[model samples]
Target: MPDAPLTQVLAPDVSPRPSACPGLWRIVTARDGGICRIKLPGGVLLADQADAVADAAERFAGGVIEATNRGNLQVRGIGADHHGLLDALLAAGLGPREAAGDDVRNLMLSPLAGLDPLMLLDVRPLAAQLLRMLETTPRLHELSAKFAVQLDGGEGLAMLEHPHDLWLSAVRLEQRTWLAFGLAGCPAQQRALGAVPVEQGLALVRAVLERFLDLARPEQSRMRHLLDTCPADAFVAGLGLAIRRDAAVLAWRRPASRAKWLGVLPQRQGLALGVAPPLGRLTPAMLRGAARLAREAGDGSLRLSPWQSLLLPGFDSARAHEGLAELAALGLLCSAGQPLARLVACTGSRGCAKAQADTKADAVVLAGLLHQGGPGSVHLSGCPRSCAVAHVAPATLLARAPGRYDLYLRDARLPGFGVLRATDLTPEEAGALLDLPTEHLDD
Candidate 1:
C-alpha cells in the first residue's frame, strides 16, 4: 500500500491539456469505453500493484489490460467507475506523485535496467531522478503528453528502434562512461547529436526540456514538429550544455540488439523470465498469475518491456524452466519463435471508430497461417495511425475493410508503412503472400 493518503494523493491540481492520448487522470473515451493509462516508473510494477490493476479492471472496466509500446499499461473499456478504478490504483502506489505529473511521466528504460549482465552502467538512479523532476516540477507539466524521454544503460536486451523525443544512450569515452543523446529519434538508427558526461545526464535533460519549451509554440507539441522549423544544430546550441559533438560521438551507433524478449533472459546475478500476454492483452488471471510468480519464484516486482511483454526479474537460474512453464500455462508466449509472439496489432474497429477492420482478429488468423512458414515481425494497423508499434515492422497489413487489407513490406527508402505490395486482399491472401521467402517478396 502507498504511504500517501487517498484524499491527498488523488487531488493534485490536475489540469491536463487536451490530447487523444490517455493518462491516469485523463480517461479518454473510446469506442468500447473510457481508457485510463497507468505510466509505470521505469516500467516496474510490484506484485501487489499488479493485483490492484487486475482487480480494478475486473470491477471497473471490461477486464482488458493492454501493454503499451512505451512499457506502460492501460486499462481499456473502463465503465462509469473511473474514480473507483483510479482510487484502487492510487492505493497500490501506481499513480504519479501528483495528478499533474501523470502525463509528463513518459520515460522509457530497459526492462533489465539494473540486472542486465552486459550493461555499461546501472541507470536506475539517474532515471529515478529524472522521473522525480518531471513529477515535481510545475513548469514541466505544461509540456505535451506525447513528449517522451529514453534512458539507455547499454543493456543488451534494450529496445533500440523505438523513437523518443529525447534519447540518451551510455557510451564509453577514454575508459569513462558518457551519455550519447539524440533528438526526435532512436539510438539504433539515428546518429547522436552530441554527448555529455555520465554525471551531467540529469542536467542535460533539464536543459534540453527547458530549451524546447522556450522555443516551441502551442502548435509545436512534439520535438519533431519543432525540428521541422528549427535546425537540429540550432536546437542543440540553445541547450546551454557542454555537449561533445565530435567525430567519435557522431560516428557511434548503438549495437543492434539481437536478444529475444521471451524465454529465460540472462542477468548479472540471476535469471529473468520474459513472457508476453497474447496479442498484448492480458486477462485478470494472467496478470494475477504473473504477479504471483514474480513473488514466488523471482523478485517481488514485474518489469514491463517495450516489446509489449513482461519480465520477472531476479529469479534463480535453477527455476528458470519451471517459471517458463508457469508463464506458458498462463497463455503467455514464452518463446520469440512463436508465430503469435512476432505479430503486433492495434485496437481495430472493435475499439476505435477510425479502424476499417478488426485488426486483432485478423492477426490471430494470420498467426496460425504463418506458423509453419516462420514469418518475421508483422504489424496490423487498423488505420494509418499505426498505434501498436513505434518502429517500422518487417511486414505490415493495413486494414481497408472488415476482412480486407493492404499488404506492405518495409522499405527503408519508402515512408508510411513502407512500400505497399498489394491492396484489398483478405487475411488469407496476405498470409500466403507473407509466407513467401524474402527473395520472392522482393521480386
Candidate 2:
C-alpha cells in the first residue's frame, strides 16, 4: 500500500508538476466547473457502482458525467462539495486501493482482459500484481499522471495503437506464453525491444519503471521524452535482469486488432455488446439504463474501453442484439455505422476554459454530415492539449476559434496530430472533406 494521500505528500505549492491533467485529487477547473476523475480498476464497474457514480454526478455535480479516454469516468461541473463527491465515490469503492496510488494508477488492459475467448492468456492476474507494485512503490508516484503502461494479453479485441511508456504484449514461443516488451512505442507499430517469459513479466515491468524513475529528469515525464536523451540499449542493459533480446524476439510485431468497439462481438464462448456514450459524455439516465442492462441481461459488470466507450460482457448471445437495440434507443451509439461513434470531442467552450469552440456541439454537426459515409474516426480538440484522445485518430480538427478549425491527418512521418492537410476549415468543410475516400486523408 502507498503512504499518505498523494495530494498531501506533494507540496501544494508545486500544483501537480504544472499540468492541467485531471486526477482523482487534482480536479482541474474547466469552463463547466471542477472536474473530478475517478479511475476504475481494469475498466470494470459493478452494477451498483455504476448507479453510485450516476448519483454522485447528479447530486454533487451538474449532472454531467464523462467516460474518459483512459477507461475512467469524470464528474463535471462539480460544485463546492468536493469531499461530498469524493465520499460518495469512495462509498462505492471507486477510490484507489490507497490514497497515494491514485495518481499513478494509469494502466491499460483490454476491456475483455480476462473474459476474451481469443486471447492467448488471461491478463487479470498479472494486471493485479503490476497494479499493486505500482501503488506500493513510492518512487513511481513521482512519475507524471500521463505516464502509462499497457499490458496486452493477445486479446482479439484490444486497443494496440495507444503508445505507453512501457508496453508488454503476450506472445507464444515454443508453446509457452512470453511477454514481448517495448519502450516509448506501441506493440502494433514498433518491433519488440525485448521479451520475458510470462513469469518474469511483472518483474520486468517493475525494473523498467524503477529504472525510469531513477534516471529521468523531472521534465521527462514520458518515456519517449526520456529516450530522446537516454540510449535505449544502455537503459535495457542497466535493468540487471535476464532479458531475451534474440533476433526472433526483437523482430516480433503485434498483429492489429480487428475488433470493433461498437456492435456485437463473439467471445470465445458467449457474446459481448459494446456501446459508446455520445461524445464520451454519459447522461445520468444513460448510465443508469446501461447499469440495469448489465445486471439483468449480462454479467454484473461493465467494461470501459479506450475508445471512451463501455461494454456489457458475459451477455447471452440470443439477447445481445436486443440489448444493443435498447442501448441505442437510449441515445447511446451501439452500431459501427453510427456517425457519432466515429467522432471524439473534448469539452470545449461549453465546459472547458481553454476551448475556442464547442467541440462537442460541432462533433454532432459533423456526425450528421458523415451519417452515410460509414464509420470514420475523427477527433475535435478544444485546444491543442487534445484531452479526448489517448491515441492519434484518423483525422483531427484543432480548434482555431469559435466554429473554425485546422484539420490534420495522422501520418507516421509527421509528429503531433500528424500532417496539416487543411487550415481554417469549419466542421462543415471538414465533414465534406472527410466524406471522401479513407485514402484521401492520412491515418
Number of the predicted model whose TM-score against the real structure is largest: 1
RMSD of 2: 3.2
| TM-score for each predicted model, relative to the true structure | 0.96, 0.94
Which sections of candidate 2 miss by over 4 Å?
1-19, 373-375, 441-443
lDDT of 2 by residue, 285-387 (tens): 9999999999998988899988889999989888887898899889998876778888889999998778989999999999989855464688999899888
State each model's CA lDDT, in order.
0.89, 0.85
For candidate 1, lDDT tens digit of each residue in 209-317?
9999999999999999999999999999988888899999999998878777899889999889999988899998999999999999888999999989999999878
Instruction: Note the residue pairs that clash in candidate 2.
Output: none
lDDT of 2 at 327: 92
